[model samples]
Target: MLKVQEIRELIKLIDESHIDEFSYETNGTKVSMKKNGGQIITETPTETKPATPQKPQPVQEEELKPQEEVVEKKDQETAAEQSSNYDQEITSPMVGTFYQSPSPDQGAYVQVGDQVKQDSVVCIVEAMKLFNEIEAEVSGEVVEILVKDGELVEYGQPMFRVKTV
Candidate 1:
């Protein structure tokens, strides 16, 4: 497993390099990381391959068609569930340091399960030595907080999950 510091360094390198994709292989462990539309997707492929003997008989074309249809339906259901759980996600407007409070001595702007109105301040993001307050774009209950205080955040990354009112 990779340490937290290593992951942090990787994120810093990614930001500094402005690279959309990166892959690393070490000790037989391979990890592929990519950022698309602000979403970070990671994929890891196992090094082991299954050993099996294949039959020479050919599969029927009509029989295989139904299997394909079943797989397609399953994929559609999975996609729909992902979208329905979070009504609207508040994403990072710019790459910066995410701060949950006005200052280190203050309470957080908002916490999980808090009710917020449109334009309510939820957090602050500091970029290039300037601190910018982030506001909720819709009125709702915050279902989740995606980033920790003082953590570096990327542009377009999901920061809050709000269930619309």
Candidate 2:
């Protein structure tokens, strides 16, 4: 559970800093905060109140059997697919509008299945009126292009998946 002091500190940081978003994860708790157009949005785990003492009612066990079976099957399926191939995720270095090419008429810097060097320009991210070229940090073949051209992207958001050479 989050303490009152911690929540106060988070609010203070958001109010004082220029950062638009913040996320924190600890143990099983996750908190995500976003500031959009002067509005602050916070997402945290829901807290459940303790049930008060009341007259006990008879419970039906038969109705829960089918739900339990479905949940078990889903868990097995998830476990079976747990060993799927892992690809290197290319995340945005900054918050900006993502562009696939230098100019509208120009071809994209990279596409799926294209080979890229460590310094290769993968795409461009326009931030605060400045167009910054983004590079592939690792030498690899592009396995996926996760963002569309001219789409707005947040800082640290995954923009591509590159299978390292």
Clashing residue pairs in candidate 1 (N, C-alpha, C atoms within 3 angstroms): none
Question: What lDDT would each prediction earn against the true structure?
Answer: 0.77, 0.74
Question: What's the CA error at residue 127 for candidate 1, in Å?
Answer: 0.3
lDDT of 2: 0.74
Best by TM-score: 2
lDDT of 2 by residue, 45-91 (tens): 11132234521311233567788899999988964563243257777
Model 1 regions more than 4 Å off: 1-84
Find the 10 residues in a row with the least total lDDT in model 1: 42-51
Report the backbone clash tally of model 2. 0
Models 1 onward score TM values of 0.52, 0.53
**Candidate 1 local distance difference test against the native:** 0.77
